[model samples]
Target chain A: MRKDRVLNMLDNAEDNIVERLSVPALTDNEKERLLKMSMSKLEGMSMNINAEEEVRGVDVYRRPRWHRFVSVAAAIALVSGAVGTGFLLKRSGKKPEDSFHAVVSPEQTTELTTADTVSTDVTTELATENTVIPGTSETTADYQAIAVDLMKAMNAAELASSGMLNTDANSPLASDSNYFKIVDGNIKGFDFSTMENVRNFLTDNFSGKFYEQHSYFIEGSDPFFKEGPDGLYARYTGRGSIYGWDKYEPEIISSSEDSFVARAEYEIAGTTFQVDMTIVKSEDKWRVDSATSTLSDPDANNTNNSNPYVSLCKSKIEDKWNELTNESDNVSLDFVFNDLDGDGSPEFFLMYGNGEYNYQIDAYTYKDGALKAIGNLPGSHTSFAVDTSSRKLVLIHAHMGAGDYSWYTMENDALKVIKNEEFEYQEWGSNEATSRQDINYLSKGCIYKIGDGTVSYTQPECPINEIPRSNEINSFTLDIVDQLYASAAE
Target chain B: MTGNEYRRLYAESPEKAYAALFKVYCDYVYAIVYNKLNRVAQREDIDECVSDIFADIFFSYKRNGEDYADLKAYIGTIAKRHAINSYRSLKLRSERFSGDSDEEFASFADDTDIETNSDDRETRSILISKINELGEPDSTIILQKYYYDRSSGEIAEMMSMKASAVRMRAARALEKLKKSLAAAGIML
Candidate 1:
């Protein structure tokens, strides 16, 4: 073994032994004895007048009730003022993008000036007045500025962490709100006091969206939020906590007078996803109307939309097909470019759609000299989009009252099913509701990716394991119905 | 209480200051002794070692002016050195007396001495002294990373640095430690 390894092992062994061996807590008598002995020793070192009276060990951290009240009130005032200002700014023709920029500016200001002033003041104070040392910064104004800036920064940070700041370039239309209301709950009304509250709120609200999205894509329910036989909770019971601070790199995709689309990408562990948030002027404050997440393509240059490389890909596919088939009637091919393998070169995707609904998907890559067909996903009558963040090809298939979406990727010259989920809403509850319930229906069956090219099929159970299974499929059914409604509306 | 608070009270009301300091750091001091002398010393021995550590702290404070930027670190140094010294003496005494009986010597010979001997103690002490010589954050980093086994993320949190930066610092500190150890003829 290496010397350092041996040493660490020995040290760890010693630590383990020490940990295992019970060390009794110091008894009251022992503590008093030790305190008295230590005090006497301290006194003997330098005889202070009235040493006996001074070392009484009284509680030193006592404060009047008014002081606590004032502190709490001040905290509340600061938070309320900042939030109110944020809302006001949004109302007064200032975008959240502006607020983000403003939050960043103060941090830079504090960083530049805080150090010099604080250090100089500390040096001067330490050299002169030895007793009255401020615990934080040098001056009250500096402290206040820092605290206020911190509050604003923290507000942004908290929002970003809660996935509220996670938005993409896509917006859900007003007509499709009910289908997505469970997925993207109105962030306007939620509280952001503590990290836990933020996490719980997201977990509670987004749990349905997560289960539905996964089930639709045939991905398993998140282990953290899953309660039991029922897949997700009816209401957000507000239980458990999620770890990590949310950090995002945001880009303003587009903006107008009443609404703006913003894309914010965030990374957790190593996986990255982009959230597209659509903010609309609701009453006075700009509220998040809808949000959706997709895989963030780090390599894809979205800025330069007219990519020459993509153009080259289109030319190659069209030229090759024209040479072979020489038929273009009633055939329309749409192109979407992305880098699936992280090789810096863009993967070319062509959707060969007939004038009707049937579309055949083919993926191509440029290697050697000519264009090469990497793989093809035999298409059905479906709508499709690429989740650039996760590098997965998403296919949405809706027929009659059933909707199924599958996430596919090319691996080893073959199509790999990452996740496939389908849901069927079997009721005309919108018309034949005795309880005036529109779109209320029964959702049945779910399937998710269990492994590479493997999927597990099961019915989603109620997330809350406490109560006996009652109205178990109600939430999932609503989500499925919502999905169908969204598909139809789109 | 903060380091400044301790320093102020140490200069002014020495007894109350010591009381406050002891109240906060007694467990910390005891933990060092307990770890260093575990399985080798009795409970009484650990208690005595802790008391000795406190005496050393008191004397050091009295000798030096009130400019302790990190009181925990200062106390850690004293406690570690004193406890290690106590453990070394106990180990050496056991080794010396083992030769008194042939059977006892045979049993002792079979059992490998994992605890530090006299030579190991000198090297360990020298290594610690060199770490202290490294000063401030480097010394603290080495102790926290290697001795306390704190993660880079945790160390980063404490130091208000990025985890990558903490890892870089730990690497640099380990390199410096190796060089210093080689110079002291420890070479580990």
Candidate 2:
């Protein structure tokens, strides 16, 4: 074939042809530069890959490669003036080591009669720390800016450790630092223990949704600037009557932009409880990252499910329900405390379920210092959700494959059903060629005529004009109904 | 280093393996890329292509695994592909800069002396002289095919001839070259 001739020509081509056509090679300088660059790039990549482990408090000895690389990088950063090494070195009271692992531990609750604020020596030392400052060496007044930064880190660690702020696992207190030491001490004065102090501290310090699985009175736009008492903090105040602390103080254990820790002590009933608080700086202010308190009593712990208040509420509901129903076996009670009517008071949403046969949903609002049942609905399966924005309560009950959505509103101290809709899935068409399923929604509207004490329901073409009907009864489901009602309210 | 040495280096120290590979193959890759791009790309661009070729080699090992039947062949293939890509991009960029449609650019670009700035003076001159002796578009076709390693289809597009005609012309030119080389007492 002709291909054989072409192949023969290609194979017979002299090796000298390629040798003669060779281009110039790169110089030694270029090779060295590229090799160094590649090594640095690999080092950076490894650091990024192991950043999570570093954040989780893994020791340096475990990651020898990372430790070696970080030591070089940190030294380079210091010498190149990328990070201020002056303050970091000055606080250690010792020469800087290659590893930078000389960490200071915060002392236990040992009170010292020192001023609450940092001293002038702190300012002078911080001034030198900020080498990035213009015009070489700066004065005391010039150091004020970075001083605020250092103070914020200190305050963040202190407040976080003292249990005055919210804390989580991501708190900076867990970070290893060499400069500051967090010493724990409890103040047993009424001034520091007052509900006013706690309210001011929480309101001023916390931002956004710090309370998890807990609700607070959020008036207008900002949750921080509420008009009335905060619900989550009320447990520690006279309003909720759960528990109160005489004084809690977080001592800055050690501080840095990278890491911070605090030793906190809380005084309650002549007993001083110790806790380790993690602090981290956020947006120029120090905040509590997390906390570990030493409260062994299960009852004293608010996080405990077996708390007496919850148990009493459970017993009160169960005792009343047993007296009425005479049913006890295979029964369970669950509750959610939330403001259902936007009235700045939490209403207990209680559910009583007996295996798969009976389910009762109830709403109890605290009035006159006692829990009063505002509404009740019973079915095979049911759910209750409140749209606080619209002051609407949604109750969905499904039985025998048919479900009804009943919307209620607070009227004259009682939850009155305003509108109700019953929906069920039905098969449509005859053959497989043209078969479909459709949702048969029977809508109703409540009307109260003048001078009539009773309300009557009338059929409506579309109970909710905006809510599009589908073959799937998504509202019949618990979570979907809650979301739908929330979206409607929004 | 051999394949076994490379594997050991990769296992012990990946950075060291990368450096060793670069040292062993950098010049080979540079030569391949520079020759391919001498006409279309600048010296700086060629240098960048050489660096990119090695970077591609490093990443390929990362992506496809470190196992290779022939490391030299793998590196050579990457170099060839990278050079081809660079040549194409440079050509496209020049065409775009000139603001010419395909037809206009091809016609205008055909007049350009392909080996004007080529290095390897003695070898290029000998090839150019031999190709010139073939006469008219036949010489251009031979140069494009053998020297530049361009395909017949691309030659056809540039010469405004059918791909089949271009292939036929190339085969005849090669036959002519064989006869000419034989006359000059050359074997291949």
Q: Indicate which candidate wins on TM-score.
A: 2
Instruction: Report clashes for each candidate as comma-separated counts.
Output: 25, 14
* Cα distance off (Å), candidate 1, residue A418: 44
Question: What digit string (tens of lDDT, one per residue) describes model 1 on residues A420-476?
Answer: 554322211111211121111111111111111111111111111011111111111
Misplaced by over 4 Å in model 2 are A1-16, A19-24, A34-490, B99-188
Candidate 2: residue A195 Cα off by (Å) = 63
Residue B153 CA error for candidate 1 (Å)? 39
Error of 2 at A19 (Å): 5.9
Per residue, candidate 2 scores C-alpha lDDT tens digits across B1-188 of 66567878888887788989988876677657756565556566777787776665565454324455456755664565456456545654554445465453342232122122223344344554565688867876765566545578776776778999989999898899768766755544
TM-score of each: 0.21, 0.23
Instruction: For candidate 2, give the DockQ.
Output: 0.03
Q: Each prediction's interface RMSD?
A: 25.4, 23.8
